[model samples]
Target: MPTKKLGVYPELLTSIEKARQLIIPEDRIRVLNPLIEYIQSKIDQGQEINLNFICTHNSRRSQFSQIWAQTAADYFGIPANCYSGGVEITAFNERAVASIKRSGFKVSAKGDANPVYYVFHSDDKEAITAFSKLFNDPINKGSQFAAVITCSHADENCPFIPGTEKRIPVRYEDPKEFDNTSEESAKYDERSLQIASEMFYVFSNVKMPA
Candidate 1:
């Protein structure tokens, strides 16, 4: 059985909820509550969650969102599964993995070596394997999912996700520009932290107790 516990990173958990509270009069949480309720209820009924995060390139924003989502969910004891993909064909760069590692995540590369789309693990027994893969219904073994669009591009370009039961657009800035800069590590770490914060915040608000 999976558990949802607010772990050592309590401040980050609080930060996520705080950010949501600050997002504007409406940040889609209202409409999203029904979906959230449904997902949580499914968990109550012993269903596993599969989430997919999408972006234009599947390199940075979407990848970061997927990793952070799983991490945050794990931290909170939620048995949620996460995946990522992009609308365009782009390889997952080595620099991105370096950034993730630098951000204090254990990274592993598996699957094909295309560099654009590869599979990676977080090195934690419970952590989901993170990867840069194309978004497709077939990838998760015919699983209907909660689809999250992490960038404006993918959200705007691909509106209907065939296997998704819920589609949520939560755009984040591109960290790929920090690619070769001296600040690349810091910038990517910042993005990871940002994603981690929000995901944990959203997970925290789910009413069902573990």
Candidate 2:
């Protein structure tokens, strides 16, 4: 287990430190295995795996997936690239950003109406750059990337994603419903932890090269 380092908030560090305790159910693991296999296959081929998590608005779940996946990849020492986009351009919601912050990340936002947020999970790790854009945004990998659909709406709507080698539907419940409610903070944190736990499960299970 990694110990807390400087620049990481104490509360957020605690949240991340406890993440390993949340066990993902066996049934959910079945759904996640394909993603694991996909990453492993890419590594076997001496190729870099790029995952783009997509949603209808590029707001909550998609952002969480991208952040967690990247964090997990780094933690597991897997050479994988992670990105997030949507069917339509919309700002990465503040609620999602707040949730990630509570998980021990240092965040800084720039711009508005489509702000770009720099989310740092640790001082030594590269910061994740987040914003809203189309699925094929210029900032993302153009081809040979897996399109991970984070929301059911995006999956059903964008059936054919151009240039993607694989399309994996790993849907998650939207925490947007609890927006502005009393459970906002709790629900958002819950969703973040869920994504983080699953991502940890995925990368942790990967067989490192011999």
Which candidate's lDDT is highest? 2
Q: Each model's number of backbone clashes?
A: 7, 1
lDDT of 1: 0.65
Query: Best candidate per TM-score, number?
Result: 2
Instruction: Assess the local accuracy of residue 164 in candidate 1 as a C-alpha lDDT between 0 and 100.
Output: 77
Residue 207 miss distance in model 1 (angstroms): 3.4
Those runs of model 1 whose alpha carbons end farther than 4 Å from true positions after fitting are: 1-38, 44-46, 111-127
TM-scores of all candidate predictions against the true structure: 0.73, 0.93
12, model 2: CA deviation in Å? 4.2
Clashing pairs in 2: 12-104
Each prediction's Cα lDDT score?
Answer: 0.65, 0.86
- Give the per-residue lDDT digits (tens) of candidate 1, residues 52-165: 888887877887777767766676567777788876656566676776665555445555654433332333435445555678824553466778888888888897778777
Candidate 2: where is the Cα deviation over 4 Å? 1-13
Q: Candidate 2, 68: how far from true, in Å?
A: 0.8
Model 2, 26-132: lDDT tens digits are 88899899999999899888998899999999989999999988887776678889999999998999898888887888899899778899988777777899998
